[model samples]
Target chain A: MRELEERIKNDGQVLGEDVLKVDNFLNHQVDPQLMYHMGEEFHRLFQDKKITKILTVESSGIAPAVMAGLIFQVPVVFARKHKSLTLKNDLYTAKVYSFTKKVSNEISISKKFLSSDDHVLIIDDFLANGQAVQGLMEIIDAADATLEGVGIVIEKTFQKGRQLLDENGVEVQSLARIKAFENGQVVFVDEDQD
Target chain B: MRELEERIKNDGQVLGEDVLKVDNFLNHQVDPQLMYHMGEEFHRLFQDKKITKILTVESSGIAPAVMAGLIFQVPVVFARKHKSLTLKNDLYTAKVYSFTKKVSNEISISKKFLSSDDHVLIIDDFLANGQAVQGLMEIIDAADATLEGVGIVIEKTFQKGRQLLDENGVEVQSLARIKAFENGQVVFVDEDQD
Candidate 1:
């Protein structure tokens, strides 16, 4: 977590009041070495949980999820953001509003992949409005599966995402929690959130 | 390669005349163990190329690319299929026509992530028409980087993907190539493709 926090402060670019671009290492272009470390951290956090599967949305989250899955020795089920053509009639669909994109998109997972017996660990690159996390939770709910916990790389603590999940009783852990991005410097929450 | 070949024969489902679905292990719900094995195979194939990075398009391809990147100790840069406000202006974009979805979508990579000095390995889940591969290659070209090679987990040999790549003189290696899909069986090519 210190490594991630350090990387964010050193390499993360603050574009505006809201956008913290860590694309150079976190999302768009991934540092696989750091990625493995992050995966190992997730594995340590969820070491005791019955995490049969790791779930994430496509594009950015898949990398960390794959890394964590490898460390945890569990399968990964990534929800496709792109529209599907071979989809059967049965699906667990949820509409998620991306606060970053400022648009809403429907994310779904096939019913066949998840079920009542499985416990899923949800992962993502960033946690902002918590829409993507909520959508993944919805899919898990629809499948009658247990929501094991949520793992995030970077979290915006100023946002309502953490507060919302806290009120809902979902166990959420973020590697680096941003207190503020004022004056072109990132301030951390300073709490060890393992 | 035998492990991957066995996974295909065991879990892969034939949809119709030509469509083979390996969602049980490859795409929809990925088996991380099998995916790791596939990554090992890809690493074994492209070991001598000195692959600086792994390039892939998003959604289904992200997982395999991440696995491969982890195995090879490189970064993974995925082409974003949907453009967002956060990535409006800083991108090297290309258009790709999805044969399955039957629509053209813009796939873009942040220009900051790729550069001329990089040697990339383009990895994907399936290579059907090879349009997506061409789109990714075009983005790499825009960056003035070179494609070290292309590694696909499964390639439909009956499709035009292999021929087009061979015509372009790009080296390709697919773990399992589907020669035919008939009578609910997914047939493998004569050998592990080189």
Candidate 2:
């Protein structure tokens, strides 16, 4: 977590108050060494949760989720953003609004992949408004699966996402928590607080 | 490669004549163990290429690309399918047609990630018509970066994708090569032929 916090400080770009662009190392262009370390940290945090599967949405979340799956030695399932020909008809579906893209898209997972017997851990890159994480949780709930916990790479604590997930009783762990972004600078939450 | 071919034969689904779905292990619901093995195989194949970065498009391609980056101990850069607020304006863009969705989308990579000094290895899930790979190659060309080669998980030999890349003198390596799909049964190209 300290390494991630430092990487954010060194390489992250804050473009306005709400958008923190980590394309240099976190999202677009990724540092796989740092990524696997984050995965190891996630595995260390949730090793005893009996997680059978790791779940995440498409695009950015796939890297860390798959890496975590490698460490946890579980299958990783990613919900697709669009309905593709390869995706089956019987699916657990939920609608998620992307604040960055300003669009609401339907995210779905095949019913054959998830079941009531599975314990799921949801992972993602950035948790801003919590829309994507909430959507994944809905899919997990629809599958009648157990929601073990959520692992986030970077979280914006100033946003209401943490409160929303807390209200839903979802245990969340994030490597880097941004307390605030002021004057093109990022303020991180105290290490002890996390 | 033998394990990958076996996985396709066992878990892959043949839909009609064109689509071969490996969502059970390759894309949607992934086997991390198998996925990382593929990454190791890729590293073995392209180890001498001096690849500085691994590149792919978003959504499905992120997993394998990131996995390869882990083994290669280099950075992985994925082109965004849509222009989002987090993506910068300075980008190398290319148009690609998707046969699955029957639509063309502009894929863009931030100019900051790639440079002429970098040697890139393109990694992806499927190489059907080679449109996405071509789009990525175009981005690499725009940046004046050196494209070392391409690593594909599955390549439909019946399609013209291989020929297209061949005509362009692009080196390609695919783990599973499908010869045909006859009567909902998948037939793979002889391993010796590859």
Candidate 3:
């Protein structure tokens, strides 16, 4: 977690007050070494929980989720943004609003992948408005599964994403927590959270 | 390699004559244990190459690429299907045609990630017509970088993907090579390729 926080401080770009760009390591251009370390940390944090599966959305979350799944040696189920021909017909779908994209999109997971006995751990790159997290939780709920926790690589706490998940009674763990941005400088939360 | 071929034969679905669905373990729901083994196999295949980076497109291709990157202890730069706030301004972009989606979408990678000095290994989940791999090769060409080879989890040799990559003189190593479907059964090509 310290490595991630340090990387964010050194490489992350602050676009005004609302956006923090971490393409150098987290999202677009990934640092696989750092990514695996973060995944190991997530596994260490959630080792006590009975996690049968790992859940995440497409694009950004897949890498970290894959790493987490590898560490836990569990199956990972990602909700597709669209109906691809490769996916089966039976699915559990949920509607999610993207605060970053400014578009409401539907995300779904094949019903065959998830079921009533699963204890799921949701992972993603960024947690802003927490809409994606809510959507994943809905899919898990639809499968009659238990939500173990949510693991995020980077979290923007100023956006109140954590508050929303907290109100929903979801335990969230983030590698790097951004308290806020001031005059293009990033302000990170306490290191103890890591 | 035999394990991967076995997984494909067991879990992979043949949809009519056009699509092969391996969502049970490859795309929709990922088996991290098998995925890590596949990554290890890629590591063994490309062990001689001096790869400084692992490159692939976002979403499905991301998992295997990340796994391979972890194996090499190098950076993994995934091309973005849709630009996010995390992406930087300086980028190397290429147009990719998706046969499944039947659309031409552009994938971009930040210029800061890949350099002419870096040797890249392109990795992907499925290779049908090689459009995604072709587009990634174009990105490598645009950056004036060196391409070590390509590592694919599964390759449908019955399609034109291998032919296209062969024509381009790009070395491709696929874990499982599907020759054809005979009466709803999957037939693999010569095992010598593995």
Candidate 4:
């Protein structure tokens, strides 16, 4: 977590009041070693839980989720943002509104992949408004699967996302928690404060 | 390679004459151990290429690309299919046509990540029509980066993708090469023939 926080401070770009762009390392251009470490951290965080499967959204979440899947020795299923031509049967779908893009996209997973017997841990890159996590939770509810926990690479603590997840009583772990952005710099939440 | 071939024959679904659905492991529901092995295989195949960066498209490609990045100890950059709000500057763009989905997506990569000095290896989940790889190659060309080779998890030898790469004089290494799908069975390209 210290490594991730340091990486964010060194490489993360602060655009405006709330936007923290980690395209340099975490999202667009990925640091696989960092991802691997995050995976190990997630595994350590949720090793006590009975996690049968790891779920995440497509694109950004796949790397960390896959790495976590490797550490956990479980299968990772990523919800497709765009419905492909072949993906048209027994799907568990949920609508996720992206505050940044200002668009509502339907995220879906094959029903064949998830069921009541599976305990799911959701992994994602950024946890901002918690819309994506909520959508995945909805899909998990639809499949009658148990939501084990949520693992995030970078979390904006000042945002409503963490509060929302806390209200839902969902166990959450994030490597880097941003307190705010000031003068084009990222201010991380102190360890004691967390 | 034999392990990958066996996995394809067992879990891979033959939807039609050409479509081989590997959503169980390689794409949607990913097995990270398998991905790790594939990454090791790719490293073994292209270790001498002096790869500085690994390139791939988002979503499905992230898993394998990150795994290979970890093995090779390099950075992995994924081309963004959908441009987010913050991604507005110094961009290299390419249009990719998805034959299966019957759609064209403009993929972009930031100028900050790639450069002429970097040697790139493109990794992907599947190689069929080679549109995605071609699109990535275009971006690499725009940046004046050197493309060392391509590493594919699964390649349909009958498809035009392999031939296209061959014609372009690009080195390609596919872990599992399928000759054809006959009666819902995957027939791999013989090792001797390859």
Cα deviation at B84, candidate 3, in Å, is: 14
Q: What is the lDDT of residue B41 in candidate 3?
A: 94
Q: Which residue runs does candidate 3 get wrong by more than 4 Å?
A: A83-89, A191-194, B82-89, B191-194
Model 1 residue A78 distance off true place after TM-score fit, in angstroms: 1.3
Residue range A6-112, candidate 1, lDDT tens digits: 89988999988988989888778888779889999998988889899999987688778888988888888888774434564787888888777778888878888
lDDT of 3 by residue, A1-194 (tens): 77887887889889866898888787888887787888899999999999999999987888889889989989998888863344446878888887777788889888888999999999999998999899898888888999999999889898878999999888999988888888897778884354
True lDDT of residue A41, candidate 1: 96
Q: Evaluate model 3: give its TM-score.
A: 0.93
Clashes of each: 0, 0, 0, 0
True A-B contacts kept by model 2: 0.97
Ranking by TM-score: 4, 2, 3, 1
Flag regions of model 1 displaced more than 4 Å: A82-88, A191-194, B83-89, B191-194
- Write one digit per residue (lDDT tens) for candidate 4, span B8-47: 8789899988999989997789999999999999999998
DockQ-based class of model 3: high
Pairs of colliding residues, candidate 4: none
- Residue-by-residue lDDT tens digits, candidate 2, B1-194: 89998898799888876999999997799998998998999999998899999999887888888889999999999999863344547888888998988888889988989999999999999999999999999999989999999999999988888999999999999988888888987778895475
Estimate how well candidate 4 is docked, as a DockQ score: 0.89
Q: Quality of candidate 2's docking, in CAPRI categories?
A: high
Which of the numbered candidates is closest to the native, going by highest DockQ?
4
Which stretch of 10 consecutive residues in model 1 chain A shows the poorest summed lDDT?
A80-89
Window of ten residues with lowest summed lDDT in model 3 chain B? B80-89
Model 1 C-alpha lDDT per residue in residues B1-194, reported as the tens digit of each score: 77888888888788867778788777778777777888889999999997998998877887778778888999888887853335558789888998887888888888878899999999998989999999999999999999999999889988999999999999999987888876988768874443
